[model samples]
Target: MRQNLSVEEALEAILEGARPIAELEPLPLAQAYGRTLGAELSARVSHPAADDTAVDGYACREADTRGASPENPVRLRVVGLAPAGQPFSQEVGPGQAVQVFTGAPIPLGADAVVRVEDTRREGEFVWLLRPASPADIRRRGEDLVEGQTYLHKGDLLTPARVGLAAAMGHPVLPVVRRPRVGLLTTGDEVVEPGEPLPYGGVYNANSYTVAGLVEEAGGEPVFLGKAPDSPEELRTHLAQTQGLDLLVTTGGVSMGERDVVRKLLEAEGQIHFWRVRIQPGGPLLWATWNGLPLLGLPGNPVSAMVSFLLFGRPLLFRLLGRSDPPYQQLRAVAETRFEANPARRAYRRGILRWAGGYRVASTGSQSSVVLRSMAVGNALVVVEAGKPVRAGEEVEVIPLPGGKTAG
Candidate 1:
């Protein structure tokens, strides 16, 4: 097993064996929001199927409106009316005109449209104050062409894309199925929330936190409940993940005497890596058991959450057939001094604000067990190993989700 790997090296090892789900399902346009497209979608029909009028006016031959102006207007007999979706069956001759509303199909033999503002109507006759032009007509298939592929495979179905699909005559869309991820929290000191807390016991925050992160990454999280630090109990809980694509466990991955998860995996499953060179989340583990991929995260609240953001989220995206980067990085000036860790890369929680430029300040103590630090922080300041940053120095920063608002 590879031990003490860098952040990038461990991620490479974890995703080398990852594969996107193959199953595809058809969903109604309304329910397919945020889902990935399973196959290429082509337009079933053309928009504006025929030459249509773009304004409320009269459809007449351009020759009939020649030399027409307010000083010497041309008058033509109004023969018929053409509203939207209804066509005027008769041909518009040189001395005749057809009243056309917006989106109405232009009458046969009419090559120009004169806006209503440029004409004066008097009962059966209408006067053309200005010469009409053919530019006022919208040609057939102007917006969308028949059989044209507008949405490609692996495309994300956003709101505008959904509307475009509807306009292309699709009532439903073929979308890739969401990956199912199994979450298991192991530790005797952890108990479910709302349950009476025993002495020196803590609530099971990892389950809910990891579950939420899974959902945000476009995966369905299946809770496997909490398991005490025992080989038998862990095996029983693991057996529940028969059809799951991935398994994630919090705690029991370090070298503590009670850390039985690693021992069991080493004896049964294939271990790919053991630890990462990252502060607050160094005890990371990746393995495969009976053909199922398992990712073990640290036990601390902050460590589990941050490690998932960096590693687990990308794995979920790969399974969904997406190529989005794990996080958005930028350079920001430091508002306060940031201490350095000589041994491992550190992800320090901080708050970012826009003041002519992005300025970041630490969010107090950077302890692994402090969950409040993540709550109050809007960004993560990356401090490279053995690099200490002073105030006013530029540093690498990754803005947290939904924290891009300007100060």
Candidate 2:
């Protein structure tokens, strides 16, 4: 097991063993949102399969209404009406026009459309105030081309992509199955929310936070309940998750006497790496137990959450086969001075503001125990090891989930 590894080194090691599943499933377009595409998607049919009108108008040959104004209107015989989904079967003649509504396919011989507001109907005669141009007609295959690949493999099925698939006449899409992850929060001092807490015990917030994060990253989280700091109880809980793709445990990763998670994993599982050089979340442990990926996070609420954001979330996205996850790193100027750790990198919770440029201000108190600072923060201002930054100094920030940032 490698101890005291750099953040990049640990991440490289962790991902070396993580591989995306090969199984694919077909899902309906409406149910595929947030799922990763397992296969590239191509349009089966062209959007607007035929040339159509952009507005309710008179579809006629441009030469038929060459020069006409309000004072000297051109009169053309209205032969037929074409509404949406129905087209005039007859070809437009030299002195005749087809009345077409918006989205109606243009008649066979028509080359232009004059807006309805520009013409008036008198029984069988339609008056044109001005000449029309061919540009008013929407050409066939204007939105999507048949046999063209619009969505690539590993792309997340967003609402826009879903709409595109449907527009191209695809009712179903191939997508990767969501990864199943087992969440276990260990330690006797932790109690589930809504349960009466005994003396010296605190409510377990990491379970819910980790569960929500897992779901947001396209993984299904299965709560395995809290495990006491005992080798037998921890082993029993770990044994019950034989079908999960990954196991994430909070607490019992540090060098404390009660840290049974690491102790148990070391005795049974293969430890890949531990102790990343990061403040507030340095004691991160990565291991594999019976061919299952296991991640052990620190006991502190902020540390566990930050560790998951930096590492666990990306791993889940990888398992889902997403080439690009939603988590992003951007540059911002520090609004206030911040001290850095002498030997470890720090991720300080803060709110990002955009005035003339992106600016980040620290949420009060950077203690790992204070989860509220993380609750109100929109970004994690990254400070390199041994490099303190002053006000107005530029730094890298990782945007948190669902938080709005400056443009």
Report every candidate's CA lDDT.
0.91, 0.91
Candidate 1 overall Cα lDDT vs. reference? 0.91
Residues 1-407, candidate 2: write the lDDT tens digits: 89999888988787787788788999998899999999988999997889999998899999988897898899999999999998899999898999999899999889999888889889999999988768888999999999999998899888998999899888999899889999999999998889999999999999998999899899999999999999999999988997899999999999988899999888999999889999889999999988889999999999999999889988987787897954888899998977799999999998998888889998889999999988889899999989998998999999898787755
Q: List, in order, the clash count of every candidate structure.
A: 0, 0
Per-residue lDDT, model 2, residue 179, is 93
So what's the TM-score on candidate 2? 0.96
lDDT of 1 by residue, 273-353 (tens): 999999879999999989999999999999998889889988987888874565789999998988878999999998999
- What are the root-mean-square deviations of the candidates from the true structure over C-alphas? 3.2, 1.5
Compared with the true structure, model 1 gives a TM-score of: 0.86
Worst 10-residue lDDT window, candidate 2: 317-326
